[model samples]
Target chain A: MGELRLMKGNEAIAEAAIRAGCDGYFGYPITPQSEILEYLMAEKPYEKTGMVVLQAESEVASINMVYGGAGAGKMVMTTSSSPGVSLMQEGISYIAGAELPALLVNINRGGPGLGTIQPSQADYWQSTKGGGHGDYHLLVLAPASVQEMSDFVKLGFDLAFKYRNPVIIHSDGAIGQMMEKVVLFDPIPRRTDDEIKKQCPWATVGKTPDRKRSIITSLELDPGKQEQVNLRLQAKYRKMEAEEVRYEEIACDDAEYIFVAFGTSARICQKSIELARAKGYKVGLFRPITLYPFPVNPLRELSTKIKGILVVEMNAGQMIEDVKLAVSCSLKVEHYGRFGGIIPTPEEVTENLISKVIGG
Target chain B: MTEEIIIAGFGGQGVLSMGKILAYSGVMQNKEVSWMPSYGPEMRGGTANVTVIISDERISSPILNAYDTAIILNQQSLDKFESKVKPGGMLIFDPNGITRLPARKDITIYSIAAADEAGKLGILKVFNMIVLGGFLKLKPLVAPEFIHKGLEKSLPARHHKLIPDNEKAIEVGKDLIQPFTPAD
Candidate 1:
């Protein structure tokens, strides 16, 4: 209800985690995303809000802390850039297998090695598909602004718990480092411990006198039990597909050409839309909010109406393959982007769109 | 809804600070905004740049390839990005920073001697504010007052004493930009 205040994208994520009533935050310091840890350090919401923030020695330890806390059915979160997130793959896969409701944020940077500090959306496939080898997916929410960086924590937790799964907030250096005005929540979050407890009865802090001991583990050695667990997970994913698929169709209603992009890349695509529109090209953008349960059905439908689909990413056409799989080979698809810390500009995309699709 | 921009220069030349201030102004305007910096080891006293996206709506993405316009404090950044400047976009530069402006026919380039201006003002720390002031004076997407308030809020409380000097620095920066000339 108060006037909005300006905040950095990293600080925004920290605030959102606390506001989401997440009981704990475990993270290590990494540029672009370090402010998340710093914000938590400065705010220290522990005594007042019953939240715990720990700066782990490494990203691996941080995620295991998240695993430990989330296993007790407490709202928990951890964050890192691409390399650190890479270290967290094993934990993430374990969390997914255990069907735990937790959140992780990857403020992506350029990679293959310690590439550069600039923002890059190169972690697309790693986050959407399995970074850790297995048949699992993180409900990845891609944000283009600081507000989403803050708000997605709440949404991630809500959906994660709703589906009994782990969710990934896949942002990049752009979203993490940027500053924006955000209407921040009050000192205390809207949710309470009792509220979270009521929703998650399986939460294991210390068992009540009347209840039996609860064990949180992903291990199912028996073949039959593993199959049953996999089936249960598949069912949960099916439910998410049926009910939780989210995306935005910008100017696509009457569009002749569609540009598919997400996270920071999608923001540039909007600028491309403006440029293309001026050039008399009926260009539109399809931004996938959830990268995991990708808006496949809608993309397939759009393929039928659009002449071409241009998928722009920071990496070398990683997500383009997903778009192709979703829409099949009916429409001509192309990749227009950059890699290794180079950000693709609207002018470059505009040139590509005009030359390839607008009959240049 | 984003009013996107690029500010590029050598690392210590206060390039990131300009983007930070613009991003702060976006916050004061109550617009959804984000700031992204070159990640990894690019900050090792090298050609540093930042992109800021300020918008009114739930900004669809913070990532952009081309800027609406850009401000170059050094030649390396200009050389790196000048050709990629949009056909009709603006470029604010420091004469001390660049030997030659891009020869693009349609684009408008406003050259400022921000580094020298800061040196003359006896407030060198406000070098970034000078260009920020140029941004406001030339074509302010957000109100100047909003940015003024943003500076007050963004700077640390201990540095609040420097507010007057910084504001004055912006005022000086505003005077440096040549008023727009109409195309005959």
Candidate 2:
């Protein structure tokens, strides 16, 4: 373990990206997540690790900068909130189509055109099911705590490079604004030019004298070739689904009822689980760590053992669709959520579960 | 034992910083701690608040509907958080901005002249530390030594020289607490 410090999640993401040897960070300042860029600018990582930190004029330019940097085989990233993320969707689609490896963080606020700056999980469908155009998938990781906020940056980058895909850290204002004690990892050195050239042979890092020039693009004028490309992307997504289904089961053993949630909602559900259990109700929490992979197997298996699964979110029933697909209607699957940035309290969640799921 | 506290006041009054310092002090003692603030527009010198949780074991949630302690610095905070404190919990307030006393029979209420003491000390910035000192004197979850260390760790190096004045304000605040004993 390295030094332990109490830091906010947004600030921790900035520090962790620097420590992870990220080559570049391009982002516009947005509420709830502006601290990420602010911390990076204050630290001046360029002085220490020679990392480039640029405040783009807009989220569109910022994500395109990520595309340009990542195409050159550099570990680049961008951060934004919901409205800003909506602006970056076009650039994100282009990055995904080009199969560029980069990290995109969404410190989610309430959505649908600048709804509010309060915390929300309404971007579940946008993050996991492809916020951008085309039939594609982003590797999404939901971090519930400040510690996980720091830890997931490295993990997101590693998985991005491993799969040659864009990875999204699906965080919300609750996790981004909250402060907790986190043990940061030891600094990892940036990948050298030689390493980048060897690992990402498809990188457009100027033509080599001995080899053919590498062209980084997503354009396929021929319809058949585009179909083939889509198939390849689908195969890659399947491989990810099979290999990277991550989740956490809290008190799931011998549970009669379970709450399915992710990101900030999962932490809220943890408290609800405690309250319900205190009232002699056998409740547990099934938290999906990787939102994209969805962790269908464990949920499918648990559906048989528990009486029912209640999907709780900060949105009005998005992940419930995924949970329903996972359970296949073997047991009752219901959703209870508070929309428009209204986070449901533990007592409310417990009361709703008792009246809605348990009573029904 | 776990202590969940809500500290609320005007944004410039260091409401969030007080919670942060207490959380840092808890971390210094190797305890699990979390600090969550009411961010965004609500923090623009309006009513701002933060929830700080310190526990011997891992803290399950940082958000809570009720808290064991409520440290209120303004009348709006008093009106908002007076009922949020659990029964048998403690409610500490600075009487400078409050026109009415905290009205609750189940919870214990105490008044600290934090703003006035800071005014007397000729530094308005030490008001939060004074209230923090009152809380620490009453609860003693983290020691004064750890709080001093927490000040060193939480403050920027450029502002570290002001720690002594803040310490003096805290000491003054420790001596000026007026416990509001409820009539039986």
Candidate 3:
């Protein structure tokens, strides 16, 4: 077992990326996520771990750098907050169009246009629906705790490489600044160098003396080729949807009401469950670990037993739509959440449960 | 048995540290616990708050809409959350920070002079410490010794001297709050 220590969400992010064997980090400084950069700057892992850490002129350059590294099939990642994430959308789409594999972390803040610097989950559509453009998707993983924050680096990169697509670690500022005790992994089994070389043959590291030239371009004038490319990516997404969807079920066996939430919001919903159960209500919580490959079958099954489903979040009920789509009317599903940087307490959630589920 | 609560106040009021002590005590007692904070600009010297949920079960969803109990250290928080308190919920407030309240009389509100208490103790910074003490007395969530250990772990090495004073503040805060239905 690894040693446990107190760390902030951003520090955990930095350490987890290093532990996950990410080959490089190219990012610009942004609020809420600046600590991620600070952490990397202090660690200087490039010197010891042989990882390249570059402070780019802007998010554009950083994500482009990621594209460059990823074009060669190396594990690369970048971090940014809301506004900076908006700027990187173009690069993200480019990476997706080229079928490059990489990871991105967005420490979300309230925004329509630089709205505020408070925590928010408003980027759900932006992240899950391909914030950039075109018919594309990214595997989005939402974490609620520092421990999970540390683990997502490994999960995001693995999924990205496994699917030959980009993956996103979408967290709020709350998760970034939070201080908690985290047990970091030590010497976990890693992908072998030979495996990486095989997986990324199209990577753009200059061709060796005798090796064939590799090109990592997304442009294809032939419509047939573009269609074929999209079909391949779609097939991979389907596979992830079927096989990689993940979640945690709490007390749902005989639950009358189930509260659905993700990331930091899920932790409080759990408390609401316990509080409601004390008053003789059978409440459960289903926390989605994978936002994109949302665990659907389990939700369908639970919907049959529960009286109602409440999708709570820090946004204006972004994931609620997914829950409703998954259950498909087996149960009454609604949303009770906070937005514009306001977070609901357990008591308010308990009241929502009572008024909506218990009363309904 | 375990208890959970949220403490909220302005940035300088030390609400997060109060939750830290409670969580520390809970973990030391071999109970499962988690403490989460609201991040971003709101925490930069504005309204800083923390959620401490300790239990025997593997805790899920740290987000909460209601609190079993809460501590309010400023007028803004009282205005923000007085209505959200659970029916018959326990609320502890620094009387100096809050100037008003809701008309409903279900909650048990304790108005403490934590800042003044700390001032008397020669360390006004321990105001949140008193709130933790109040939490311990009111909820009995964990033993006092666990809190002392937690304080030891949470405090910076250089701030070690203040631990005893903070503990004293906790003792004082606990003594001031009224009892509640004991945890089973």
Candidate 4:
């Protein structure tokens, strides 16, 4: 019902960040995702909403800038591809350890090391399993469409602030570059400094007589305190797992087999389900909108009904591990993927489902 | 109804833009549409292609292996995508730089001398519009008014003056397209 426009996934993310009243965006340009920065620079949100859009020298500097902004209780974010995101791992770990609210977007490209500038979901492990280090977990939202790419900016920031944790919009090159119709939400005004101070009482907003001087750091010299911090982080992750598990089930009411996928792969499996059903196979699609939290309970319940599950991805098989863990190997779970930027087609997915699950 | 199409040609041949226009036109008609382009270094001077899907229902996948129609411009695209068209589908090409014609017997083949036509029109950039015009003639997926609106929406405001010229090229293209017949 809002403004409808045709936009690429990357452009939609940028526009959504601006409209979400994001206070700052510090990012480095990278292939497949440079459009996020390019669009921000072109739109000049600073002129409109007073949002600071900076092009840092590298991903490391950009993420550090995010740390600075987040510590000050500013709604801040940064986006990058796989290689660029790899450069920011240390910074990300520090932010997570510090419990700062920041939004990070990884428009994932093919990877192991600068693999390709094409779409891939290989970063599933790196994103959800704490790519940086420590016992921290980032709330990862995997958007399958350009529309969700726009919607998740606001949602990511909201969840980031809600849990005082970092949130990631884990997308891919295909969704980044692909154009689709999206209905944008109405613009929300950026919070004033006083509003931020009131909202984030723990933020390092300067020493005031009314409150204790806030210190922001991930370091704990004493082993006892560090263990407590790790325990607190684990508790928060468990809370997220219980409260924020988001997934979509299509035609699963009577399906004998299911395809579990996220992001671009989920969109492909939707079509594969249609094709499989046309050929008299009772197949369904289960798409995880939130990669973390894993959507384990619903999937486990569905596993009891379905005979098997085909875990499809753009990687050689990363999320498959999580899928297996979710179902506890109760049903035959198989993985079919195309790594290094190759996207599997609908026909290929359908054929794999038939051979790997039904016929095999 | 759903139409999955692939438009491929050299980077400068307006292959991506043509697909954008088609997608925008679909949007103008309040239809679900997606345009997924092949990006990166290969788009600089090499073959560039875009997969476009317009459907009355929600489109499931933007990346497809085969298409209902293929609008090809250069020979490289013809070589790569000729076999990717569905059997009994349609293949439309410029046939300007193509060395080997599409040899598929199952699909309908049509050639539009858009490059030569654009040369005669004294505006080479409108070559893609001519090809688009040829496509609309056969399929008529979108109406002319929506296309005018699509051109307005997709093209920058500075290029508004060129819409009439592009429309003229589309009209020229509608006339220039012909069914391909192989010589025995």
Candidate 5:
């Protein structure tokens, strides 16, 4: 109980970033998520914690700025909506390929192109799967509450540095714009330059007399060397898959049906679980906290106990593919969603559970 | 107790800020709270609405289809949200520019001339506060002291001097609200 305050998810993320001792935040404003940059600017963490907050000319410039700062062994991050995130795909791939520890937040809005400015989880395929042209994956975290929106900033940074890989906090407009009560953590002091040099020996912190000069780039013209780079990246992703799967099971012990969802959809499904249970239907919710290294094993285990899974999302059905693969297509796995920025109600989810999963 | 509330009005009517103050009050009282607004282009001169849920338990969905209470300011909001209130719920509104009034027989209805009252008081900005006062009169979810704390926390410190004025408007609202019986 450090400090209790009512905050929007975007505001909470900005506060948490500053409290996490983040070194820099470079972002271009976008609807539903412009609050992140707005809040940061208003707070002026540059004066408070000596953090650097810059409004880049565009999303491409923001991502490149993030790359530059991260390469210098500074804790750096950027936030954008779906369209802006699309502009940063190549940069994200470059960061991933360079093994730079950076954090990215995608407060997704409805999108195939420049979709509506309302909440949508339509970026599941683009975020968890490789959005850019590369053999890579961003460790994606899906925060279901404003509390997690605050908490995951530190967690994302920790995970990013642990694996030396970029991490994405896959959020949506609903979570980004909605307000909730949150207890903030105490501020962790920003790391000193010497501390960063000691922590990130691979960082481009200028030529040191004690060690070889570190070059930070994704380019490897030689085919054999590029293959080795791909192999190393693949092994790191596998290691993440083995250890980093995170999820939550609510009333799952006795459930006959499970609702698989993340972020805002998971919040709705929790209410649906209560509604369905009152009607004598045994249902539960399985929320994946980490979307990239999805909670595949636990869901596979839960699949043996449940009758079916309704993969609810704000998207048409992006995450359902992963849900299908997780369970090996052993049971009925259906998708219930409201795309184009429409959020399905809890009653609709309960109705879908009754008609689609149980009856259908 | 879980109270799901919707506050709807035109963009400049302070609908979102009223909900924010209420949610902040809940936070002051150690309750779980969430405020989800219908944002984007609709918030610019168009109808704006926010769904606020204050509960003792962890709130599940910030987005909701129905609410236990609806605070409607305009005719458009009343037409849209009057039916969305749960049966035996509460509907509070400011009847300043309304042709068609609420006809719901299941839920209890109350009308407060907050806009008119604020205009008469020569403080039109406190119109939402008047409505909030009316709401507290019906269902005192948060204490007055906590509301003071809420305003202090939600509003910028530069605006702290106006807390008493807002509180006075709330009192005016508490007196002005009248229980409505539909004219069949």
Candidate 6:
């Protein structure tokens, strides 16, 4: 708990990174998320904490910079929107393969290509299903509130380092641009190089005479060794699934029907739940705070009682597949979504739920 | 109780800032609040709007359909938001640049020459503050004292000197409001 102030989600992300003791930030500005870079430059956390903040020439260059920084055992981060994140996929895969802990944020905008600047949850599959080229997973955290947008920065970094894996904070334009009251935490000290070396022994700091040189690379030319690496990564993901499946179940104890959503869609579903309940429908909400380690077991258990599960998203049903798989088709699962930056109102979500889930 | 409001005007009319101030005022009063603006290129010179909610309980969606209050500063905003006000809700407009009057019969409508008042005061930037005053006069969801505190929070310290003139514009706006009477 700390001082409360009204701030935008993007601005909160920048401040939280500073407070979280992040060592460096390399980013290229993009719409709806450019404020993150702007805030960092304006605040000049470099003077306060000696953190490095660089406006890279491009998204490709920025993510590579993050890889370079993370390889040195430094807590580094970068943020981009839809297309920019797409450009960072190759570097992200490299970082994941090297097991370099870093934080990546995608303040999503509408896109198959360079779509609208408005918000969209279309990046769900890109974030959770391994946007990069490899058998890898990013610990994806979806934040619905401006406060969660701030809080997840620290959480993502902690989890990233804990598992020696990259973490992604998947947010949308609505959450990124919207302003709300946020309680900021006290600043943490950036980890010194000795502490980083002690924790991340595999990190590529200058080779000392006391120990062997650690080469950071994804290239395991041997197929068997690569298979072993893949197995190890899978084991880590499985552990994450069992231990780190974060979700919120709202009024599900007596609910006959439930809406499953994440990020901004969860906020809209909260209102839909209220509207449905006012009309005497036993509706509740299930929000996945962690998108990658989907809350399969809890959802499967909840599906035993609920008659139907409606997945709502700001895209063309990206998360619905995960919801359906989580429930194992045990309960009737349906999806309601609005894509291409057309945000569905609570009334619209409510109407769709009544007609699709309740009536069907 | 919750007040879901939409304040819209042309870019640079301080529409979004008004919503931010109101939201900050709500926070100063220890209430839950959300302020969401229609961001992007539309904010340059076209119609701009912001949705603000202040409540005693936790707020849900920041994006909303109907609003408890609509404070429109121009004809474009009036045309866009006049229908979005909930029944028994309030619509406050500057009426300086608006061409068509609001035709809704179910809501309470009020007019204030906020832009003209700002002109008279020679501080054109306070026009949005004037309209904010009109909305607050009808529905003091956040108290004026909290609003003063909100101004302190919303504006950078360097521009704080304008707050008093903004406060004065608010008073002038309060005095200029004319409550609409329904015709039989």
Predicted candidate 2 versus true structure: per-residue lDDT over A118-177, tens digit per residue: 999989899999998899999999999999999999999999999999999999999999
* CAPRI classification of candidate 6: high
lDDT of 2 by residue, B1-184 (tens): 9999999998899999889889999999889999999998889979999999999987887899899999999999999999999999999988886787787899989999878877777878888888888888899999888888888999999999999987887787789888986445
Q: Write the per-residue lDDT of candidate 5 for residues A1-360, one digit (tens) a residue.
A: 689889999999999999999999999999989999999999999998999999999999999999999999999999999999999999999999999999999999998899899999999999999899899999999999999999999999999999999999999999999999888999999999999999999989889798679999999999999999999999999999999999999989999999999999999998998899999999999999999998899999999999999999998888899899999999999999998899999999999989999999
Better of 1 and 3 by TM-score: 1
**Cα TM-score per model:** 0.88, 0.98, 0.83, 0.99, 0.99, 0.98
Model 4: per-residue lDDT, tens digit, B80-113? 9999999999999887878888888889999999
Clashing pairs in 6: none
Instruction: State model 4's lDDT.
Output: 0.94
Give candidate 1 misplaced runs (Cα > 4 Å).
Answer: A1-3, A185-197, A354-360, B1-5, B26-36, B52-70, B81-92, B95-114, B140-144, B176-184
Residue A100 alpha-carbon offset, candidate 1, angstroms? 1.4
Candidate 1 vs candidate 5: which has greater lDDT?
5
Judge candidate 3 against the unseen true structure and give its global Cα lDDT, from 0 to 1: 0.82
Weakest 10 consecutive residues, lDDT, candidate 5 chain B? B165-174
**In candidate 6, what are the lDDT values of residues B9-41, reduced to their tens digit?**
888889899898889989999999999999999
True-structure RMSD for candidate 4: 0.9
TM-score, prediction 5: 0.99
lDDT of 5 by residue, B49-164 (tens): 99999999989888898899999999999999998999999999887899998999999999999888888889998889999999999989999999999999999999999999
Ranking of predictions according to DockQ: 4, 6, 5, 2, 1, 3
Candidate 5 at residue B136, lDDT?
Answer: 92
Error of 4 at B96 (Å): 0.5
Give the range of the ten consecutive residues with the poorest summed lDDT in model 1 chain A: A184-193
Per-residue CA lDDT of candidate 6, range A1-360, in tens?
597999999999999999999999999999999999999999999999999999999999999999999999899999999999999999999999988899999999998999999999999999999998999999999999999999999999999999989999999999999999999988999998889889888888889986579999899999999999999999999999989999999989899999999999999999888889999999999999999899988889999998998899888878888888888888788898898999999998999888998898
